[model samples]
Target: MALDPTDVGKIAELARLEISEPELTSYVHSLTQILDLVGQMNAVDTAGISPMAHPSDSPLRLRQDIVTEQDRRQSFQEIAPATESGLYLVPKVIE
Candidate 1:
């Protein structure tokens, strides 16, 4: 399941990445190792095994959502460089 250098070169070209010879060699080696490990999994014979989300059977606990704060809009707007009609102002970009 090793990736071809030609495929790598094409992928680099499509991604606009500048791959040097050393980088290409390093990436190829790393990618080859990953492919070999994945290939090893195909050797396993899991004929009828159920997939699991977690190793344990316990459900995860979650926190209750609560509103705990309020914004001081007038106090915040007082620090703005520009504001009008209860809103911060910015330079108009289009007519």
Candidate 2:
């Protein structure tokens, strides 16, 4: 699970990042430790344990869904710079 300079360079290139030689050394060490920790975690035996969505067993409480506010679209649209058919318009950004 050790990461070398070449592995760090490839990761930096793929992520569009610029890493100095000093920073690259630090990154390599940190990444290697993280990978080693993950490797250790993966080596643990969990054959009898079932997968869970949450760590706790508490039930979640949900509120009733209902409209609690009045629509003010016309008032807001009247103050907008551009509006057409109750929809706001903006300048085209892409060709």
**TM-score of each candidate structure, all chains considered together:** 0.45, 0.46
lDDT, candidate 2, at 40: 81
Model 2 scores worst on lDDT over the 10 consecutive residues at 55-64
For model 2, residues 1-95, the per-residue Cα lDDT tens digits are 89999999999999999999999999999999999888987778988988788988778988789888799999999999999999999998889
What are the per-residue Cα lDDT tens digits for candidate 1 across 1-95?
A: 78877777887899999898888988887888888988888878988987788999689987779866697889999999999999889899789
After TM-score superposition, what is the CA distance of residue 9 in candidate 2 from its true location, in Å?
0.5
RMSD of 1: 8.3
**Best candidate per lDDT, number?**
2
